[model samples]
Target: MKNIFILAFLSVAIFSCGPGSKTIGDTSSSEIATNDTIKIANEALEYEVIIVEPGFDSWLISQPPRGYYGQTKLESKNRQFVAEYNTRVLNPTKYSRNLYTEQINYDAAVDYGYEVNYLLYNYFMYFQEKYNEKFIGGRN
Candidate 1:
């Protein structure tokens, strides 16, 4: 039983070393996974990246969900987002690629990628403040 107790104690100690309950890849709080690639929510057309670009994430977080913006605004914004995002994926050598997968998969980030919204949002804010730069494009 001593082994079990040691394991439990070590687990708690390891987990407690961070800011708090916030763990890597965990967006329930403010922690963000630096190694994040890309995650498509439900494997469908709606998705959000953890932290890849600055300008893009900034623009994305500014708006609301499907019903949040008017049809015209939503379409215009979505188009802009898609265009900028595509530019990033098209250039894999860039560092923004760190924000998501290496392939040109825009579908996963659309509509904030569903469940990853909260996590992405937190990452965005933290990234922007910490980096002192935008997170929109790879070159930028």
Candidate 2:
């Protein structure tokens, strides 16, 4: 009788303390730390991309490579540049939302002509300031 009771009690206790059990005071600091790390990494990536945009534009402009024969290659390249620039600027993420689609489109329109110099200049300045503020800790 006693043996039977002890066996039953032990089985119940073991089953109740199985892997899926969580005590009342259980809290996960590792999960919080992981989330923080992800946030920082994503921010760093954004800053890097923004900082690179002006240099990319300048490289594209200075290439002077031939485009498709017979067609207006400059216009086509400018369009591609605008699309890539917009996509880079509007990188999807949890923290930053893209609210400047129209601005990019407008800038693309202006870039189709020879007016992109000013826009590119401003973008470079903005990117530099933002990059320094976010990643470089305002050092540069």
lDDT string for model 2 (35-77, tens) is: 3221111243232112223234444444333331223443454
Q: Per-residue lDDT of 15-124 in model 1, one digit per residue for the tens?
A: 88977675544563222233233443454644334344434444555545445434444344444444555566677776456653444344433454324444444443
Best-matching candidate per lDDT: 1
Please give the distance, in angstroms, between residue 4's alpha carbon in candidate 2 and its true position after superposition. Answer: 99
Clashes of 1: 15
TM-score of model 2 vs. true structure: 0.24
TM value for model 1: 0.32
Per-prediction TM-score, please?
A: 0.32, 0.24
What overall lDDT, based on C-alpha atoms, would model 2 receive against the true structure?
A: 0.41
